[model samples]
Target: MSPARSDRTRRPVDLRQRSTMAGEASAAEAEVEMALDAPPDPQAAAFFDVDNTVIQGASIFHFARGLHRRKFFTTRDLASAAWKQLLFRVVGSEDPEHVAEARASALAFIKGHTVAEVEALGEEIFDEAMAARVWPGTKALAQLHLDQGQRVWLVTAAPVELASIIARRLGLTGALGTVAEHEDGVYTGRLVGEMLHGPAKAEAVLALATRESLDLSRCTAYSDSINDLPMLSLVGEAVAINPDARLRAHARDAGWRIRDYRTGRKAAWAGVRLGAAAGAVAGAAAVGAALRRKR
Candidate 1:
């Protein structure tokens, strides 16, 4: 077998044995009792979605912005910005395929760069650009759970590489994000794992819970979109933050906690969310105004 494949196959086994075991051992002495205690039939987790559910807007948007600023995307994103405007103007539905394709196109655009460079870029994107973009209340809520000793996790459709950077920065446990397929230290412009969206997010969360020995009944989940219902349905305490109409209605009917952070533009709709405000995140301005002209 090629050395790369042999290495990749062995790395996970090694990582799991070392990393997960170390994490379990380290967290063992601390109060994991939150997952154990509670009334009979305890729910044992607090799941947070990235991209508008935890951060100010779509994590992808900010990451894309960062990449754009660094000269990653082609002229196509701008060209598509126009088409997005027109599509939303006329049809009111941003095609999912287009969304995925755009993401693939973007990832493909940056394929050959080293993971370290991407991580470095991500560091700047999170700290300098998106750090202040968190919503005032969301961070507090997440901290409360962590302080209470409950495990906090970020589950998103973002690429794991990008999501892990943000998760580590925020002191969250880890992220289960969309896996962009990699081949010999390169991106393949396609997903290697499940796209953690909608029902998929719930699936991912549940899987993590099982792996981590977490309890779902005692767990809490926060989100801003109807699309996140897959995640919200699996838990007892679902907090809706700055919810859209459909999710708002669901939150109201289900008696979910609805919190708002946006200051203005409260109407039937305010176009497709370049970002959504949920958890501790607020919308951030796009990245790369400097390189926008180049594209």
Candidate 2:
């Protein structure tokens, strides 16, 4: 096997063994009780979808502003993007066509931009603004996995650079996102493959599982929209956080856990007979990485 592939497969096995050992030695019985319905698997993972699942809105909206300041796009372009952001907030993005169009628009906009330049801008914007908008409950859950020694990864359609920033700041393992094609340190205005949405998200998680030796039946996934159904369905534990209409219906019928924090009310979980609530986690810093499409 190639050295790169060999390392990818070997590293996760090592980490999993270490995690399993750590979890077994942990004395946090209370936390374990909360997730008793689906017992913890140290070798598995807790995958979270970004955007509405973890943060208030699309990370791309803020990234657009940053790019505008740097003259990547103009005032008129920013206004249009802002309008779309408002609509996304009210009406969740579940439509495949809508997602595709957004992806195309973002790819077109960033064409020819140097990867390093865009990544640097993304870091600045995220540190300045995006950190405050993360949902406390979701952040807590991600942290719980970390405390238990399970892998935690942010799965989104945002650029890998932006996703990596959010994941690192949140103290999670890493991220999987859309890959933009670049050559000689410059973007080629094309994608490496499909945008990481819908089935693409599911494929990425499965690939990670293969490399990590993660048990899909023991893994958990959280999302807020229907577009992530394939991913949510792949895991033993599926959580719907601030779910849109479609996902809420599906979660209800499937008896999956649901948490709603959009109404200024305390977030409550539904359909699970758990001993305790997932413990509260301290707020972490958030940041806008860039204007990229998310499903």
Task: Count clashes in each candidate, considering only residues at least 3 apart in sequence or on different chains.
Answer: 16, 4
RMSD of 1: 10.0
* RMSD in Å for all candidates: 10.0, 13.2
Instruction: State every prediction's TM-score relative to the real structure.
Output: 0.70, 0.70
Q: Which stretches of candidate 2 lie over 4 Å from their true place?
A: 1-42, 69-72, 79-103, 264-295
Q: Candidate 1, 151: how far from true, in Å?
A: 0.7
Worst 10 residues of 2 by lDDT: 275-284
Query: How many Å off is the CA of 8 in candidate 1?
Result: 35
Per-residue C-alpha lDDT of model 2 across residues 1-295, encoded as one tens digit per residue: 9998886667545433422332222111101112334425557788898877887666655565555566654566555544443232233344433443444554654565587876787788788767987889889999988777687888876666777788878878778776667788887776555556666677778777766678999889999878789889999999998886778899999999999867643333332111010100000001112233210
Evaluated at residue 120, the lDDT of candidate 2 is 80
Give the Å error, residue 262, model 2: 2.0
> Model 1 over residues 124-238: C-alpha lDDT tens digits?
8887678887776877888787777676777665555667777777776566665545567754444443244455566566656676666777889988778788788888799
